[model samples]
Target: MIVEGKVVKLGDKIDTDVIIPAKHLKYTDPSYLAQHVLEPLDPEFHKKAAEGVIIVAGRLFGTGSSREQAAIALKAAGVKAIIAESFARIFFRNAINNGLPVLACREVTAYVHDGDEVAVDLRSGEVLVKNRGVSIKCGRLPELILNILLRGGLVEYLKSAVN
Candidate 1:
């Protein structure tokens, strides 16, 4: 699968709390969580993300809390994908489990800037920065993970498998 969007740059160690603060975790509804996604880090994130953006962040992104809501909120807010230097293990799994494609490209942040148009090919793990004419390689997701994402998260994948 391929995901293309304008970039939304962020720094290191963005945790679950900042992604969707606990105060807003009252509901598991994605749309509701989207409204509060990154409210602590960027007050206008909801509006900016609604227009479809890809987040590119530094190492240890999603470093705190294992709440799956962070991934849900981001996906609902129209974040097509997230490219980070590295991710907290649980967050990475949670992202894929929620059908939020995340790529780990060590040099991605170097090539992408905020608002730059980029395209990500999940199968090839290539991150192309359109305006700059640069491509960064990230680890390709395994077929099983890809299948889960394609089916729209773990639960859906499981449901389909059983049927």
Candidate 2:
């Protein structure tokens, strides 16, 4: 899958709590949860994300609790993909399970600025910074993960298999 979006830059160690604070977990509605995403870090994050973005961040992005809500909220908020130096293992899986494309490209954050347009080829692990005419390589998603994302998450993939 290939995703293109404007960048939404964030720093290292952005935790699940900041992704979707606990106070808002009471509501399972994704749109509602999306309204508060990264509230602690950036009050306008949800607004920016709503415009469709590719989050570029430093190491340990998603380094907190194991709530899948974090991934859900991001996807619902219109985060097309995420490129970080590294990601918490659980969050990585959750993102794929929720059909949110995420890649770990250490060079991405430094090269791409907020609002810069980028195109990501998940199958090739290539991130193309449109404004700079640069391409950075990240670890390619395995075929299984790619398949899941293509089908729009795990549940949809599984359902298709059973048919």
Compared with the true structure, what per-residue lDDT tens digits does model 2 show for residues 1-163? 6899999888999999989889887777888888888889888888888889999999998998989889999999999999999999999999999999999887877788988899999989999999989888899888898889888899998898899
Clashing pairs in 2: none
lDDT tens digits, residues 17-93, model 1? 89988887678999888888999888888999999999999999888887889999999999999999999999999
lDDT of 1 at 93: 90
Please, what is the TM-score per model?
A: 0.95, 0.94
lDDT of 2 at 103: 92
Best by lDDT: 1
Local distance difference test values of all predictions, in order: 0.91, 0.90
Q: Model 1 compared with the native: what TM-score?
A: 0.95
